[model samples]
Target: MPTEAAFSWPREFVWGVSTSSYQIEGAVAEDGRAPSIWDTRCRMAGKIANGDSGDVACDHYHRYPQDVALMRELGIGAYRFSVAWPRVLPRGRGQVNEKGLDFYDRLIDAVLAAGIEPWLCLYHWDLPQALDDLGGWTNRDCAGWYADYAALIARRFGDRVQRWATFNEFSVFTLFGYAIDWSAPGVTDRDAHLRAIHHVNLAHGLGVGVLRDLLPQASIGAIHNRQVVWPEQDCDADRAAAALLDEHWNRAFPDPQLLGHYPPQIAAAIEPYVRGGDMATICRRLDWFGLNHYGPIFAKADPQCTWNFAWGEAPADAPRSALGWPTWPAAFRDELIDLSRRYRLPIYVTENGAGGSDSVGADGAVDDPARVAYLRDYTGALREALQAGADVRGYFVWSLLDNFEWGSGYGPRFGLVHVDYTTQQRTPKTSFGWYRAFIRDARG
Candidate 1:
């Protein structure tokens, strides 16, 4: 790793933290906020671990001023947070919730007043439950509904917020929710799975157009979660399986948006939904690329699997986060280099962090040396890519505080600051001090 005296980064490089609405803001039924698919999912028996829900998360909705103060103290240049879809449109369409909009307006102002730039994400898997009642993402009209919501928010706050992300991790929702029944609105149907992909692509492109027309000065992009996929065996069958998984997990989403067409492997499968002029609508030009990578995947051939590949289990000795995600720093650097070579857009490491089983000590310090080392190792690879001339403009840790971790509940913690879910107290972890000092020294 480079020392302080040997570091090289652009003067305007952004250091930030990312949080999704459903993951942190816990007021599920407050301020005219209608129920989201996640709320419904958490209520289903055997769906979540320990029967935990985001009903009271970190209570950030009621204590955002405190959260903003924490961000200001951390010395980050930006704060990326999502707008609750259900909060803004209680029924998903046809009516606006003024109270819901007021909440974000205040949140945005607080973030700006704290001297940090506000990066807005329009959707983060908290689809309004009412939309699920009407077919949700599988419905083709969802494209127009999302565009309408985008237009309303853009026309309201576009002047103050210059950066907007249309959606966050489309594959996680469609793959887990529609294909595997592991997430909200769970339905395991092959046809509905593919339909969700096409419709989300349409909604994103349409939302981009809406933002550009109403707020031409704004920067618009979508956050895509991608990683390298390696074959479990060197043989042709396993190689083909990994290729198929990569095509769907990695290339399928961005190819249509950036290259104006679907990958050849999936074109025939989704051709039924291809209408005239849809490609152009789905290929709207983005101002930048946002990547959310955890680690690479190893895939083995599996005929019974929906995608013809199954995630191979890691060896007993392999390094993993508390969440069991593999740790591969070299692959992280390669992802940056590959993305730079392929799309050549200004890149942002939008979501990168490791989850650990952290706890507050008797000394009142969260001495998570494991998490500190993880951040150091991962970011060392990031610096290597920067020196190799990747146009990386920003890097944001996966989160700011320990919040809800989806179906895993709150057991897996990925945060620079630790939050006591009971008392709602925020405690800065050891990594927080390391990052603050690193940014201070590097920016000097």
Candidate 2:
């Protein structure tokens, strides 16, 4: 593999890291914050690995200043973080929590003081438990509720935050939470899944409009988790399964939001829920496309599953990450080129990193050669995509710290900085130094 010096990055290309609220901020019950659906899922037996929860993941709610300082030390140009909807709106709507809003104000101030730009993401799957009780995203009114929440965030943080993302990975939560019994407020019904899809898209469009109106100067976009879907076998059923999964996974959110209509397979089913001018309401102009690509996903037919498809395994000979995900940098390169051509918008690789089981060494240092190699190969592919006319503008690593990963819990560490869960001590990994140097060289 070529070294970092071999590739050239674009001028003004962004270099940063990202983290979500529930994954890191662990003041679950403090400051008048209410329960998100994930909070409720944590209490359910057998739902999460080791029965773990985000109750105190990274303790970032109380330790954000230290985290911000770490970003400055790494010379990161931008910091992408999400606001816990339940934290700001205790019931997900009506009655704002000043304390919750105040915490973010302090965080934003600290981030700016460190000379880093703040990119605020409106939602990161932490829907207030109160809202879930009222039908969650399945209900049509959920879109209005999300827009209201966006309005609150805009009015409070808009002055400081110029880059805003409406939602992070819209299809991931809706699919796992509604169609599969894998995530919070778990349900496995088709109608419920369709409703959630349309409602979330509607919410995103409405949120975009709100941000544009309230924060006219803000550069707004929505983050999507897109990946190539492949069949597990050569059989027709498996091929059919993969096709539908592709529509749901790759095109579901971006299609309606970008092209103003649902994909063919989803259009008929979702039409019932989409009222007059709902597509017009759900499609809004934006500044960029946030693409979160990890690795390609494999799907197989499953009669038992609600969607008639189940997650399949990658090829036996494929290179695998420590967490069992297939690691193929060519796919990353192709995805950027394809997304640029398909969307015709500036692309930002918002989340891309490898997860591993990392631990402090006998010498009190964390050595993660796999992560270092992964970053090198992936970033190299990013360069190839850019050179191929991908319209790529930026790339932000999946995370800065190993926080609570949903379902899999905290076992899979994706952080460039190692976090000692017991002591909350952050030790920069070998990849941390590598990324810092890569950023400096990329800028020059």
What TM-score against the true fold does each predicted structure earn?
Answer: 0.97, 0.98
Return model 2's CA RMSD, one decimal. 1.6
Please provide, for model 2 over 1-444, each residue's C-alpha lDDT reduced to its tens digit, 9 standing for 90 to 100.
345456567779999999999999998999999999999999999999999999999999999989998999999999999999999899999999999999999999999999999999999999999999999999889999999999999999989999999999999999999999889889989999999999999999899999988988889999999999999998999999999999999999999999998999999888788789899998899899999988899999999998799999888999988788998899999999999999899999999999999999999999999998999999989988887779999899988999999999989999999999889999999999999999998888
What lDDT score belongs to each candidate, Candidate 1 first?
0.90, 0.93
Q: Specify the highest-lDDT model's number.
A: 2
Show the lowest summed lDDT stretch of 10 residues, model 1. Answer: 1-10
lDDT of 1 at 224: 90
- The collision pairs in model 2 are none
